[model samples]
Target chain A: MTDIRAKLRGFVLEELVYCEDPDTFSDDEDLLEAGLDSLGIMRLIMFAEREFGITLPDTEIEPDMVRNFNALTGWIESHRQ
Target chain B: MQLLEDFLANLSSHPRSCCLVEGGLRLSYREVAEKAGGVARQLLTLTLPEGYPVAVALPRGIDATCAVLGILASGRCYLPLDLKAPRLRQRWILEDSRAVAVIGHAPWNDLTLPWITIDTISPTPLEPLPLEMENLAAILYTSGSTGTPKGVALSHRAIHAFSDWAKELVSLGPEDRIAAIAPLHFDLSTFDLFSSLSSGASIHFLPEGLTIAPSHLTAWLSDTAITGFYSVPSLLSFWSWKGNLSASPLPDLRFLLFAGETFPTARLRQLAGYLPHTRLYNLYGPTETNVCCHWPVERETLDSDHPIPIGYPACGDRLYIAPRHNELWVQGPTLASGYWQQGQLHPFLNEEGWYQTGDRVGRNDQGEYVYRGRLDRMLKVSGHRVEPAEIEAALLSLPQVIECAVVGIEDWEGIRPAAAVVMQQDEAIPTIRALLKRTLPTYMLPSTIRRLDSLPRLSNGKPDLVSIQAILTR
Candidate 1:
């Protein structure tokens, strides 16, 4: 399985084109204005769902909430409850 | 001629006029016409269904401009799908409109349609725009929250009527180069594109992401030598607050047009002082009816202590207020055929063929309509009739808010009016709330009044209510 950080790093690196390692990018970086499009969140959705065997609801995901590496992962952690 | 016919006729008369511009790039009238013509020839070869909506999915700019003209010239209706909107939005437009084909670039190659990737940046030149005004010109898709995006069908006649009034509204001539601000998907672009072309004037399409920045907007206004600019009040307010237009070189732009929502008197005053003689016009209409009413404002009207009236209906059209300040009804040549997937026409349009604008409006003593707010937005909170527009209007009248939106939410507690506001820089948020208490009833005073950095807007220049809801909930 892909390490979650690697997965996050690769996704951000590929799309945003700049910036560095996923370990450095926190979970709270507002991704909407952070050069990441919603497509970045979409990729994260499929990755999290496939890895955790849980479905992410559209109502739960929005452009404003998923701005950084930490926020996307945090959303997953909170939803697990 | 239908709308396309009028454009084609006008384009033929002035072949050398600058039709599309981006950065240093420019396309003349003859060049655009030839490209659209070639596209028309190619479209004739396709096995398209009659009344088929050809999806033009691209960001607004020079390429999308030509694509729209080409779709009309090809004798097919074009549907502008905002590339910046969510993929679901793009997919929704195609599926709902049942588009037969799409004209896009390589980046959008994966979009589902009988796709034609026409790259204007390549060495290939554009063909002429095809079609008469009698044909379907474009099918514009406007999305409502919680449902599929509905396509508004406009024939050549609708666009013609709109452009005819638009050209007349501004009296645009060859020397009048207007700054094209809104995206292709937005109807506001009608003036800059068709109206400019109709009069052999130039359209300088600003580069993507240039519309928002205050500094960038000021630079474009001066460098492009734009005679006029069209925008919503929010943007105009930003330019005014930044004091970017204070310079002489920064376009004492002849005309400033505001639509989509009411222009606060504060905003109007700031802009009016900057460009003293500039004709400030307040245009009102929904996408369903194009522009049905216009109120040309002088600085004098702004001084009056009344709700700013939206002015009189222009073109072959008229506006009427429903009884008791209910729905606003519009009738005219610019009325769209109906929503593409329309099960029923807009509820406001009764048997008489008037477009029912869900917008609620009241009239001043002069019999001019003062736009109150959307009738559909009324809330039955705690068995009480609550119109957010009322609260917003009162807040705006208080001299603090540049613009604001009042939304109602019913949680476990009770129903309450929650306001999200954008304030003038010198003003404090607490002072606004204090003022609201003095003027408004206790129940009417917003339980939660929050200030936003800036209100988000959809491509159509209206507040992004969905995004706003998210912001408030967060």
Candidate 2:
């Protein structure tokens, strides 16, 4: 779980977000509010699929599924084969 | 005349016909008319000037639609404000337009303008005010090369001409269910709102944030049975790339119109393969002139790797190429009146009534207008018009550093604004970004910020944009 969270956070901070400080961004911080726009969200999904080798369903790409680092980890875990 | 006439005709001819669909809620033409009439009655009470600008700060939905219609009915210019934009930017637009009142659900106590809550008012029997064709209909704000945004004041005649042309071009009818995907602030929404409503077609308002989820967006289009759609190429490309467009073939989608940015030939070919039944069109124009040129994509043209032509003139617009520079100049009925700045109408058109579009064009052997590029430094980042100067101005406003240069960094995804700055003290990327967030919208915010020793200068002492772009790319 920590591995998944760390990977998700690393990718988001490196690519998806430019405003938030990675070291200070809490696990529960809202990614959307941190300037993760629609394009960023799309790129994040692609990155997660390639990194984890899991097919995240398009219908399941809701705000609740990827709102925060913890939520992103749980979503990836559920989709893991 | 087309807007008011068609709206009245639709109301009388098909009172019970479904006019708007958002989520599970469906509003008929009669219901929409009643709600809009209520809003109009409330505006009539104020007795503002004939063409006073009224801002609509509400989110995109049934209420926003009714508010716009009510503003038009009351013979006032409707100014749609982006609710998600930075508060300071919104305040700037409000001050520039000198809006007499705001029609919204929530009370904007900080804005000192008259706030008219549409829901609180009751529906009353009323008729639309007799407005002339030259009267202002809407004012759309776009990123200016200067620091502030410029408002393009569109007249009723312009809206009438464009909507009429769009209605005929798509052969829109009562049975067509159009998707209102673009926000009200975007120029594309004018077609979705005016063309759909005027033609008696039903419009489905896609919920906010649904655009972020490509798969869900595709599913929503299929579930809603949307027959017509208009949007920017960025969103369509994103949907085609990741939204599983091949798996979910939207049969109900008849015509797809894309504009605001160039659509890559390869991505467009893939999209064509995914949706073979739908017709694709490339619309071209700035907010100053609504859809001056358009090209219907033929399968044969997609075989080549070259960019598609913007094709023939649209909306009764005449295209002219300047001799010295290949800049495209447009003269048409759909031309906006002028720019609304400092509560004054400043005419942008030349003496001959031709608006010089900053875009460069070349005529093909077939005499079709081929888009070359923009003559100016303006960049279309994700279908949003962005001026590097605007971002640079915002960055310079912050006392953090010395000089800065902003440029568009183009990757496989699309072009995005990136900045290189020389700072007196070392500042974190997040700090600069946080300061910029107060003034710039999320799209205008630079995706990448790199601290530089100094920006490369040319022989004339101007910042060398090519070298800066290379640095950002590296």
DockQ, every prediction = 0.02, 0.51
Error of 1 at B93 (Å): 1.3
TM-scores, each model vs. reference: 0.69, 0.95
TM-score of 1: 0.69
**Candidate 2 residue spans exceeding 4 A from truth:** A1-7, A18-20, A49-60, A74-81
TM-score of chain B of each: 0.76, 0.98
Q: What share of the true interface contacts does each candidate keep?
A: 0.00, 0.44
Q: Write the per-residue lDDT of candidate 1 for residues B370-464, one digit (tens) a residue.
A: 78766576543322235677678767887668888877755422355677899888776556765664444334556566788788999999888
User: Where does the lowest 10-residue lDDT sum fall in candidate 1 chain B?
Assistant: B120-129
Cα miss at B200, model 2 (Å)?
Answer: 0.9
lDDT of 2 by residue, B1-474 (tens): 636778789999999999988888999999988889888989988867554699998888899999998888888889999877898999999998888999988787677888998779687654898878999989988899987798999999998888889889989999999999888889899899989988899999998787888888888889989998899988888788767787899999999999999999988988888899998989999989989899999977788889989999999999999987899999999999999997778999888879999899999998889999888889997788999999999999999869999988998778889999998776777788778888988889887888998899999999999999999999
- Cα error, residue B147 of model 1, in Å, equals 2.5
Residue B132 of model 1: what lDDT?
64
